[model samples]
Target chain A: MNIVVIDYGMGNIRSIQSSLLYLGVKSVIVSSDRNDILKADKIILPGVGAFGEAVREIKKRNLEKHLAEAVLKDGKPILGICLGMQLLGLSSEEGGFNKGLNFVNGVVTKLYGEGIKIPHVGFNQIQVNENSRLYNGLNSEPDFYFTHSFKMTSEDDIGASHCVYGSRFVASFENNNVAGVQFHPELSQNNGLRLLKNFIERF
Target chain B: MLRKRIIFTLIHSDGYFMQSRNFRLQKVGNLLWLEKNYKFQHISFSLDELIILDATRNQKNLSQFASIVSGVVNDVFIPVAAGGGIRSLADADLLFKSGADKIVLNSLQYENPLIVRELVEKYGSQSIIASVDYKSTAEGHLVYVNDGSKKIEYSLKEYLTYLEDLGVGEIYLNSIDKDGTGFGYDLETILNVKDLLSIPLIIAGGAGNEKHLLEGLKTDGIAAVATANLFNFIGDGLPNARNHIISLGENIANWNANS
Candidate 1:
């Protein structure tokens, strides 16, 4: 499959590409080029930096418009990780009030509660949605590696897998071919690898 | 619940991975020897995270070190944080481009905090880890930098606060006295200073067995336990330790059969 990772000179495209390589996806491309996005069989939006800066880079490379066309219009499956997931939402509170692609009906906000840590960094358990394509065939409360400050939540049915850090936040969300996970599946051992495999096969 | 972590640390100096004892590095073996025996690729499945520190004492050739890091972490699908002698963003850039999910900072944390701030701004706080090596002296817990050679003025508590204010994601607190000793972690010191910062803390140095690891993880506020002692936990040592911890009901990650 032609899996093109959207690299706007900001995301950690290496680990995502390697994870796909390990999962037996032979043809993977890490590019922000319009042609690569247009021709991609699937797009993986992997990010490791800030939301505001990431949006700037995406717009700078013209990935914003092309990605919208490829995913929204063409209906190509896309998986967004961490900040990439947040960028798929409407807005976030991190790195100043930021805007996103609005492909999914969600809004990013800082996860807060009494005695809860910021940038919840570690392997946290996720309670996947009943019919999540991203979390298909997973055991209950499966663990995934999370390292971020802001999380997305929406009143709309986005088919989210919830993880409680300080409070309940969207660990992952799937709406048809559009998918996003706040945790780093590339870093989260076997369960993560399985999730990626599911994305490649089921999505 | 967020599960605690078991991290395997690889200490590289000159051209080989070394076993560190009280900051004195003993050359263990080359990458080939490590692969043949330890089988990090196999054992890493049981580990939650991996930290590769370049302890080259001399003026560090960053390209050579980055190459080593890239080679070591090619297949390990875990959070890999690499650092040691990183002075500029270019050096960090090389490491991250190679495969590092997070860039570790030590001397730069105290020597050049502005650059550290810039890294935090660019990579976000979650992408930077502040590594503090402290020696329990007569005065108290003292912080060290420059490959644990030069002692700094700030105490452990003071230094951590500085790092927390500076906005590094996590803390890798290593005991210089307990490193590679195989005795145990400095639990007294860990307990004494665990509440100083709000960030997740990964305690390293002197984890001899699975129980030592369990003791560190069981301690309140300790997020992860790391060991750089090669001979102590070589080959099946790590996998055994992980199973022991999980069987006892500690919250380390457990992969299924197909996984």
Candidate 2:
């Protein structure tokens, strides 16, 4: 299966590419071509860095429109990780009112607490909300690593997996072919591999 | 569902495990036994690349780190990477003998770029991870040593090229400005290095959330991104981050199939 990982001057691209290869699916990293985006069976908008910067690169490369069309119109599978996931929302309060990919209806806001710390790091449990193809072979609550301060807040129940940090925040969410998870499966353990394997098997 | 990779980090210290949490101090010896016991029970079940940083390995803690390495050598079978205060071929040798699968060299790369060539030649390119710790200075992001106290007037791109020419296989770019800040990694610095090299680059510092991980991964050539305080008894971080990634991978997998 061909997977195209969108790159826009953010974080490591090789780890995701390697993770895909390890899961037995080869992927291509593309920053500037429409053909590459159109040709791929699946599209992945992997991001790391600031929301504004990520948005700038996506728009700068002109991959944003094509990506939106592919996932929203064509029903092609697309995944956004970490900042990429946050970018799938309407806006984020990280720096300013930065607009996201708008595939899902929500706003990414900062975690509310002082002594609780800013970047919530380390391992925590995940309670699977409703049946998701993503949760295959997974128990109800599995330990997953997390690191983030800003999170997506939404009123729609069908679109998110909630995790309570100070207050419950959206951990994973999906809207039709468009889906986003505010986590890095690439860094998680067996649960991570299993998660990737499930994605590959589905493809 | 989305797919993800695994990265494990270790920090070694002589004094004690001094954390931001209530100024609690755990004796090194006592911590080692607990860590070792945890590894013995949990390691086999997970897929993670181990990263060991000898916080005090410079002069006093060398023997201590070596002993620690020996203790976990057999129990932890995954790839073990060691960093901190590595300056010479001799230091690299000690780490390798102690069963470090990969040796991370940081400040030494600046003192003498040729050391990178020598180490890579002896250990092969993959074994040498040239770590660069820098902070955003008024001048630029300056690489430094002695735990980011000393500053060197070198652009990150310049050092990347220098190390690349030296035949160093990988680079661990740590942003001192972001370290402990948990703001997320300095993607700008990581991208600068990623733009220049073909080698694997790991972005470190200021990873407060999975958002930082995603940002680090989005860089064109980054191989891995790491955070210290995230994995252990820090905030409710590591598990949430890992699980989120796993859920993301699962999301992509299912999305791919049905979509």
Using TM-score as the measure, the top candidate is 1
Candidate 1 C-alpha lDDT tens digits along B91-120: 888999988899999999999999999999
> Which pairs of residues have clashing backbones in candidate 1?
none
Docking class of 2: incorrect
lDDT of 1 by residue, A58-176 (tens): 88888879999999999999999999998898998887897899999899987788876667888989988999877776788898899988888899999888999888989999999
In candidate 1, which residue ranges exceed 4 Å CA deviation? B257-259
Q: Is the docking of candidate 1 incorrect, acceptable, medium or high quality?
A: medium
Error of 1 at A119 (Å): 1.9
lDDT of 2 by residue, A116-169 (tens): 433444345566777566657766765555556577888775457767766778
Q: Hey, what RMSD does candidate 1 come out at? A: 1.0
TM-score of chain A of 2: 0.93
* Interface RMSD (Cα, Å) for model 1: 1.4
